[model samples]
Target: MLLKPGRGFFFAIVLSSVAPVAGATALAVDPMTVLIREYSRGNGSYEYLNSGTDESYARYILDRPSSPYANIKWSLLPSPDTPTRRAIESVSTQEHPVNLRDLHDMKVWDLGFTKAHIASETFRMPQELRYVPGAWSIVKAGIEPDIYAQAIRNQGLEHPAMTANYALAAQLLRAKLAATPPSLWKIRGLRHDVLDRFVGGEFMLAHDFHYLIQFLDGALATWDAGSTSAYGFRQLPAPLRLGRIAAAYRQRLPFEHEPCMEDDTHDPEHAGEGTFDRRPLCFDDATDRAIHVWYAHELVQELAAIHDRANGAPTLAERMAAPLRSSRQGWIGIPRPSAIAEVTRIEVVEAKVTGQLLVEGDVSYRDAFGASRRALRLSCGMRP
Candidate 1:
């Protein structure tokens, strides 16, 4: 039942749903793109960049600017080697545009690349390992088996790449669960360390993830999707209201809107066309302090911009090499998002496709300079 190269509804591919739990290579078509789509359209992975799509360029090495919890991992990674980063910035030779293919030398993990090779054969080698929020989201969702068996209860609505991260993480965990045991989650090591990283954090919506897992697990216990037997399922976590989180941060930052709302969505009808205009906006409260809170849609756009710029290569590198002289404002290099859409249609196509993902009912944060949030769609394809 695993999706074949030319079968199944495009992005509707899910591991456990595709077939009986027999093996990790259950599906014929790779599940990389499908997993990214789950985290909202904004996220792209290391696998994606190396992909043939023109959108599969460099910059989004870690596209978590929209997610509040993204920076934790980015900051933890070794800073892009200053000399190498400087060389990349210097850009003496523009022969190679530094696409994913050009990143073979990036074997060691840096702020912009994964430590594991992109083409490594290890099952542990992930297609997309750059985004922390997405990675943590997937790991959290897969903490227990039943959590995934009863998946309907989990409406992974927020965090730019969080849901996508959950999808990939869940898939790998499923593979692990197939041969190993659910108790592996309890054992100490990579899995347990990841659990502690996210769950231990008091403010990264840890309880939301916990309740989501519990709710899904409980729902699975019952056959009906509408009804649940456990009391824990009845007490679901409150919705992820984008406005309130923004308002709380607004209190500290100098957003055009004062004392931003505690709970609200984007108003596509009347919104500014800038990075700060989105729900999961990031701005430093004070110097050297950056805070990012990503909405489901905002991160989608944020990730695209990051990738496009990185793909552009040496041109961007030269700009990065430019020094900041006097009155300093952090370099705001987010390119205009390619697709400000309403609906996204994911397909595994040739490299010609790469655009922003659009989610319906969710407000479009950018202005209508050349943007419209109509029945819009973007596709991230892979050429195999």
Candidate 2:
């Protein structure tokens, strides 16, 4: 969550001779569909001028026996009536279609539509929504740090090709932040946003793929962040999963800045549509609360390694420093920040989690600065 945002062109490839083998480290993202979204409209209207699939990734899925990512959903497969193809059709009448051959610059940042699709206002199709695992969101950072952390956690070791780019992205952001002057250190703090361009950027920077299926699959087996309704409407799973992952990793996760008053909030889906009333938010997955704490405990250990490392422990930080990524650039490798010396880093003055709480806030959007503030805690008088 401490990484920074970047807007620059990157051109590099990491080729590998590794083959898919069941039970071996591999990723299962097949000719992935990359959204070439040019614009987004009101009323959820989206226009994707073009998109393409990575055939190599597709083959990896077919060859691999185990994978965490849901296998090629029927909708993702290329066919005459595919969503991506149909999406491009919608934009054709408005402007000339963007064909695969027409993409002259695949260096991510160089694409004409890179910044547009990265913004939340832009549109995205179902396939683009699922395929694009946002890794770098520089502009529409709903809340910078949270976005960066979620993206890191969401890199749940699935979709090897995508993970490779995330690793690269993490490294890039960290390097730039570390290089900044001390006075400007505050400018480099992490942020959270849902723009899909970050994921799209990672897709273009990918070198290859693998599938470490089933790894950490059970980490949350005893927990369920959320699920869909009978009508197929899904819920936000980040809050639920974030606490659990932090606990699983045993990271002493920080709570969101709690608001003074608990009040109503707006619904994110129908924001300007003036549909739902504002309501208070609270974290109440008590069934898994204790484990959540446990995961947070583990997470902090990894974070510690990032700040100080001698390269001996086989921990997450060490592994991240040198990840199993096939990409030329790897994990957001942490660098000694230039201003860290002058900066007052977070320190343990008096830390305790005896009856700790998991403060929850409005899901409509991140409550970062001011305005309508809200907070709800998910903790109780019980022991794990």
Q: Please estimate how well model 1 matches the true structure, expressed as its whole-model Cα lDDT.
A: 0.24
Per-model TM against the reference:
0.21, 0.19
What's the residue-level lDDT of 164 in candidate 2?
26
Compared with the true structure, what per-residue lDDT tens digits does model 1 show for residues 1-384? 111112122232112211111111111211222322322233322233323321222122223333221221211222332323333333324543332212222211111112101122332413342232222122212223233222212322322232323322333334343556657645622253333333333222333343333332322222111111111111111111111222222223244643213222223333232335544332211000111122323433433333224454433212211221000111221222222110111221211122232232211223111122211223121122
**What is the C-alpha local distance difference test score of each model?**
0.24, 0.23
Residue 69 displacement (Å), model 2:
27
The candidate that achieves the highest TM-score relative to the unseen native structure: 1
To one decimal, what is the Cα RMSD in angstroms of model 2 from the true structure? 23.3
Give the per-residue lDDT digits (tens) of candidate 2, residues 190-306. 221212334333431111122111111221112111132111222112222333233222112223432112321223332221112222111111112222222232333334444
| TM-score (C-alpha, index-matched) for candidate 1 | 0.21
Error of 1 at 376 (Å): 11
